[model samples]
Target: MAGLAAAALLGTAFASTDGLARTGIFGSPGLTENDTSEWLNTGAPDFREVVESLRPSDLPLPAGRSWQPVIDQQVADGQREPARMQATGVHAAFAHYAVCVWDGEWLAARQAGDTARVGRAVEVIRGVPSWPIFVENDGGGTVDWLRSIAEAATHGDEGPIRQHIRANCTSSWIGVDQ
Candidate 1:
């Protein structure tokens, strides 16, 4: 079960990168290491920059919707192509944050005395990404890392488990977890 959860999280991470690579914006042929440095200068690298480059800058949404919802709704509404949605600058950060949120929510479910909900979140989190490097490709063994955290949560060390997850996921798109 723990292995499944880690795999799901990692899978989401890689799928996000695959989305960007297919978008033709971030990983353009000429993107040197220096170019990556420049792109990092864009301040708060949300996926909206990719959307702004690909489509009209004036798409309507509520004031505080996350990038995933915007992109997901766009796909659901047939307003944009899957490729466009994947290409959003928000993909990488969103995926990273999603895993963090998934861990926190799952830990909460388990802590709040809802073991069933914890299992469900675990199932979905497993399904989403599989492992962390599937999203970022740091080393490998992210599955083992996730398993350790899950074990911690199962032991009622919810706070530390969440803190560990958040530390692994401090990215530019979403702010650090508070």
Candidate 2:
């Protein structure tokens, strides 16, 4: 899936920026960082059952540029639905990774102390997502906002944010470390 692929890319591609990558402030991936093998094996059965039970092709991506606001309002309202939280690995697990990677890129650009790169990266990463509004404590506010949008879009009971980013914002994957 595009979301999984994006997550994998974040895990490996932007290793420098990903705080989870030792270089990043987040530390590193724990024991479950092997690959998709585990997630696939476990999720396949349930996902198959869900597929068999639910109708296919029911999902539709949100209209152009509108989703960003809705997501923002939701966040501003402080609505973080735990039920909607991490339901799907693609949305939850992978989305988180992607944001982390993006954040790492943003911070590196900032830390490199390159004002121009930081500005460019901020612009690029910010535009990558529909709802660009995440609370990134890493100093890269725009990048953090974009990352938040990814997480919300993926985790929210809505369209495939992961797919959208993969298709439209591949360049956003370029972390500072990459």
For all the candidates, what are their Cα RMSDs to the real structure? 11.9, 17.6
Error of 2 at 52 (Å): 22
Which residue pairs in candidate 2 collide? 17-104, 19-24, 105-176, 134-145
lDDT of 2 by residue, 45-146 (tens): 133332222222222221121223222322332222211111123233323334444444445655577667555545544445432112211223444445
lDDT of 1: 0.42
| Maximum-lDDT candidate | 1
The Cα local distance difference test for each model comes to: 0.42, 0.33
- Candidate 1 residue-wise lDDT, 1-178, digit = tens: 2332233222112223433323343333353221221121121234444433444232222223345643443333222222222232333334444556566566556657787867765664554434433334323555556566656555656665556564654333323243
Top of the candidates by TM-score = 1
TM-score of 2: 0.27
